[model samples]
Target: MPTDATPRPTIYDVAQRAGVSKSLVSLVLRDAPHVSEARRDAVLAAIDELGYRPSRAASALASQRTRTVGVLIDDFHNPWFVELLAGLRSVLDPAGYTASVADLALETASGRKPVDGFLAQHVDAIVIAADLAPGTLERVGVPIVVAGLRELGARDAGRAVDVVAGDDELGGRLATEHLLRLGHTRVAHLAGHSGPGDARRRGYESAMLAAGLEPITTGGGATTEAAGYSAACALLEAHPHVTGIVAANDVMAVGALAALRERGLSVPADVSVVGHDDSPLAAYRYLALTSVDGHSADVGAAAARALLRRLDSPDAPAHRELLALDLVVRGSTAPPPT
Candidate 1:
């Protein structure tokens, strides 16, 4: 009997199986913190078992506001966005706002405007954490918050844009100073093309000069692990005596690691390496990378706050916020071999 007996299960089925009301399940789905842990677990388990998927269409029709925000990320390959998204949802969920994320890298490949999809869905605002090409953000209409230091800026976009980012220059300075304090003077910086990359490079240079040491910077291209490896290879070949390196990000730092090993140098013993982002790769016991924590989550939360404020008062002065950063010393960096 191939009747409608196996009609797709709904939230009602989930609630009944979890032995709870539909409202409780809804609260859990919304990630409301007030839900008790035990009940939340039961609801989630039931959802998994029944394979119940929430209908965003139904959700939008019921809510007064579209309550959807668009988040534009630079690259899906970078893990830095993981923490940023977590911080974003922490505030967004409680406010009944849902996030719709898009990758700029993928969007560009399809030759579509980065925010076109969001506009079609009528998102309330957009968070930009990517470097958009010229005119890509022209007359976007929605409230826009530039979430990180990228090649793209509000002024360049020809629109008033709120900005919330980590002070990347400070992060670079902290990393260099940490290595300098550990008796390493010959330090090199692996460069990239992003806005934060330039700021970090400048910070490294200034720190080197302050100590009467010359700075060597290279690789003004992509910020991927492969680019880092290429830059490190060139740096080591040109200046084999270089004892310390500060890469643009953790992935790049991983690249530097391989370069060092190829040259038969031991981290912190023969050469020290410091990376930015403090990504999961940095924390791996095998890596234990000395890194700079830009407080990405805090930056994301601040950006969300800025977006909310702009939504409330579109004419208010565009907010500019730059959270401070700090260095996390680990086994990857230490005094140069004496």
Candidate 2:
């Protein structure tokens, strides 16, 4: 029997085998609108025979639109981000746009700039949460929308970049006020770090001042369970009289609950606690955490919508949207002991 013959194919080989011009082959590979279906089909068939893959860089240069948005999150494992992503997908999926996510774990020691990777991919736009590394805006060539974050004074190439955020300060105030209304005078706040944390802290202070009470903050970094636990322990040690606590986020609140339990304290009795973010775990029957709803889903959806608008009209005016916050009273909170 004759040995079977096989041929390795390149773009040039596909062009020749397809009996089409190299330019036509290139256009088909790039999915350029200028090429007709008949020629595209012919080029595709030749590509299948040769097992040829088009160069992504060359194709991207030919087609200006990548149909992809870059999303950079501070941490990937956070449940808040998961909910935000769902909201983002609800808006972007129907519009045929996709997102590329970059997670920057606080523990990562790598000096690699994740923003550079997104730029290298030629993503059409970028959505970044709070606490982004400095200089990200300067390097990004495409439209950038700040989600759940604030950019103090970054130039936007004369085109206004959009920002979508929740009223974290208001949420903080609401949480504090709720605790105050429950007759808890010595309420301690487990404040998180940076951005949202600062805003919420301000609100807590404002609410306390308005109520003619002093604001006490147990400063903690990030909204982690460990941070909450540590902050709660510190608060209990410093101010044993404190009867209520408002954590910056649900994670910290859960930690506070655990801390209270470890101390042989009961929720809503020894120390009523309220958390921010209203994460899914907050609603569990066992936890029943009273928390502030930052409406992360709405913020995510608004960010996606803002990005699409910018993509459609790059020169459109810069916009800022602030979503509302609601207080969800659950079983975790109660009036201080008489």
Summing lDDT over every window of 10 consecutive residues in candidate 2, give the lowest-scoring window: 1-10
The whole-model lDDT of each prediction reads 0.88, 0.82
Task: Let me know the TM-score candidate 2 reaches against the reference structure.
Answer: 0.80
- Candidate 2 C-alpha lDDT tens digits along 1-338: 11124443568898998899999998887778978778888898998877776776445663577788888887765677777777787898899889888876742346766676677677888888746655656745688888885533445334488889898899999999999998999988999986888889889999999999998999657678898999999988899889999998988999899889888889998789999888888888999999998888889899999999988888888998889899999999999888
Q: Against the true structure, what is each candidate's TM-score?
A: 0.80, 0.80
Report the alpha-carbon TM-score of model 1 versus the true structure.
0.80
Q: Which pairs clash (backbone N, Cα, C closer than 3 Å) in model 2?
A: none
Q: What is the model-wide C-alpha lDDT for candidate 1? A: 0.88
Candidate 1: residue 182 lDDT (0-100):
90
